[model samples]
Target chain A: MTHKRVLSLTLNGKNRQDLVPDNMLLVEYLREVTGNTGTKQGCDGGECGACTVLIDGEPHLSCITLAATVEGRKIETIESLAVNGRMSALQRAFHEKLGTQCGYCTPGMIMASEALLRTEKKPSKDTIRTALGGNICRCTGYVKIIEAVETAAEEVAS
Target chain B: MTEVLPEFRVVRPATAQEAAAAHRDNEGARYLAGGTDLIPNVRRGIGDPDLLIDLGGIADLKKIEVGANGARIGAGVTLAHLAKNAQIAAAYPAVITAAKSIAGPGHRAAGTVGGNVCLDTRCVFYNQSQWWRESNNFCLKYKGDTCHVAPKSTYCHAAYSGDLAPVLLVMGAQVEVTGPEGSRTIALPDLYGEDGQNYLALKRGEFVTAVLLPKDVLPTVYEKMRVRGAIDFPLAGVAVALRRDGDKIGDLKVAVTGTNSRPFIVEGIEELVGGPLSDEVLDKIGDLVQKQVSPMRTTLVAPFGRRRIAAALARRQASALFAG
Candidate 1:
């Protein structure tokens, strides 16, 4: 028997209440229940960081996290990174630097970078690499992705 | 495509005793921690537990207490906390290093020390998708009757690949466990068994609550050999804790993981006591590791190749620790 509960969480700065299954993963709830397809599931499970999201401002694998466990927590996905429909600094940086090639891993990679830039206004290249270490981009070979994050950090700092 | 999780009721327990009671009340109930390891296995149709007792609500399990008697790390403390905690970084460099080396940034943010310590044995044949396993006709660790890794043998050869177990084992840590019966403490080595299928020796309904470190911390180093620097489990991991007495080694302990069913301390380490930090002693340490670790065809890497790498890691870590 599947148990269901009304999960109340802050999603993308908006309070949301959804009757989700206890076993439902956060990624599933975001994409299916809330119609937020910004998060991607790259691997069969947690092998890839394509489903990364920020839970309370920390990058966590939403694919492995149950939706019910995150009750009342602030969840930020790639969908939440814009201000009044304008692309955030990190998003603009990715676009300008050509950080994405196929764009499959961009949402998660950008969200992971978003978390890092929030805390660290100016992070070293090594720090940026470590922050996005979980994120895998087969395209771009991470060169442009690193440059995008560096440009975003400089823009945010300035 | 995203894999669908099996249907199960999640029960949030506030305390360790309550969690144990919940597990006892529900048959085939599993304690859910960070879910980094368990969720993936569940998605792969490994063990289908009907109930999941969520331990995230237990605040006590998420504590780290450092006092005169050393530190007691609660089971639910996240790996990211361990990696960034100033106290842990200052007092236990090896622990922090191991925590940082686990998986990746997202994984470390969600994964916990207890979950890593109790991680299931992994094999190339066992950790695949359900369809993949079905096509291979299963293995000895799960539903299959025959051991695919050792086909003729009756035992499963899946190797334990947790990074923290070796570091903790080398530092002489103890684990505090709680179960349906009661609570007790045991040395870290006693927590594991040799059988790959049933490696963890915890009794039914019992789970580790906390790990207690000794008052006197030693200089230690952890070395891991894997295909990638991030998001890959170690092929062969080694941890060495040594105290230098002038130019000689004193009270040295070496533990190895990822090559056996159970992470274990290499025997005959006492023989190296008082020995100079020379190439001869380092070779002996490597030889001892190669002799003790029993690696099978559990991963893409060959068993002998993993054994050699494990020995090399042991020797390299021991030499580095001795030098410092």
Candidate 2:
């Protein structure tokens, strides 16, 4: 009884089209249909934003966002952070600062931090803290994550 | 909760009237706004809608218009958008504050202001997996007779957890509801119902289109108590808007949430309006609120403690408005 619709979207700067079920979540579309598994799903619930993605340059919980709703919008996932096969500044910062102990939360943390830096050139620790509040990192304490964001900001600015 | 939604037809409507028409036509149809709350509820098997009326394409419902009088926030405006709006921040700081106080940044990016205003009244017993709820026959909220919170009571005790509801109520906001019949504007207070089983007082095939705030400027403060600094529902929340007359309060409004089935404005605020609102006066109001609202055991952080927190929130917000 469900409906199947063609979803045309800008994924990681590339225009793509696919037939998706009306009930498919944005996260499921990214992982199952498109085969982009960098976006993890820790808690399918809105909490523990493991599935955070950029919809129109803003961080959103893909687990709750409907794939059909974002048909024509731009979606930037964790995989999009790398440029020409080189790690993005935020990803490199996370690597150097030891931002991930288990690496499960790294994708979401990077995407969230990327969204923050994309908008604000120099975000304070409190601002960074607020920006990353949605995504959870149980493996590494946030000290390294905060430092990585700070470092990435300097690199992006320079 | 189930991850996959049950089979349902998707209707992409471009206008509010067409969306309302879809609602009117389909037997079991639901308006899909932000879908942050509705999707999860559907996953939990709450409402089995045969047709999903997708309202995302309606351009008219995605605007935030700031006029000379006040602001008109569309039902489809996301909390993140409203929170970051410079005009809304300057004019309706309380609304911004309420928007920011919701779940988290990512959730806020997807959750709508109207969704929060029409947020489901929550209860521990009712909001669980079927197996979890079925462990004991489901509660009074759905498919069960006994009120889990108060076994002898006849009604559900789910608390209204929306942070925006109280803030909008205190600001004297009006809501525009669209339906198959027509569109009508009503005070924010009239939009709600007292019963937890059916929280929103909407006519069949009706949905909220926009929220209209009052024009008059007033100093407003919103205070919330929660277990965590963020991503947690308020145990007790208070919104206070003060109309000042040269240091003395000319008019005052208080709305309390997370303490009852429906968020409501405190009555008899006029008694405290005509004079300078002192700490003593604030404390008296707090005590009265504490006495009046006894939080039930739905979301369980000791009822008396939540009551006390509600009172304290009101006192603190009132004092802040007075100081400002």
* C-alpha local distance difference test of each model: 0.91, 0.87
Please list all clashing residue pairs in model 2, or write none if there are none. Answer: none
Give the C-alpha miss distance for residue A72 in model 1, angstroms. 1.6
For model 2, residues B1-324, the per-residue Cα lDDT tens digits are: 445777887788999999999988888998887787788778777787888898888889889999988889999998999998998898888888899989888878888877888888888887777677778898899888999889998888888889998889988899999999999999989988777888888899888989999787578888899887778888989998887789788888888989888889987776887888877798778977887675888785888899999998888878877777
Q: Give the runs in model 2 whose Cα sits over 4 Å from its true position.
A: none
**What would the per-residue lDDT of candidate 2 be over residues A35-100, giving only the tens digit for each residue?**
999999877877787889999999988888879889899999999878899998899999998887
Measured over all alpha carbons after superposition, the RMSD of each candidate to the real structure, in angstroms, is 1.1, 1.5
Candidate 1 lDDT, B119-232, residue by residue in tens: 999999988889999999998899999888888987888999999999999889999999999999999999998878999999999999999998787798998999988999
What 10-residue stretch in candidate 2 chain B is worst by lDDT?
B1-10
How would the docking of model 2 be graded? Answer: medium
**Against the hidden true structure, what lDDT does model 1 obtain?**
0.91
- In model 2, how large is the Cα lDDT of residue A81? 79
Error of 2 at A70 (Å): 1.3
Score chain A of model 2 by TM-score against the reference chain A. 0.97
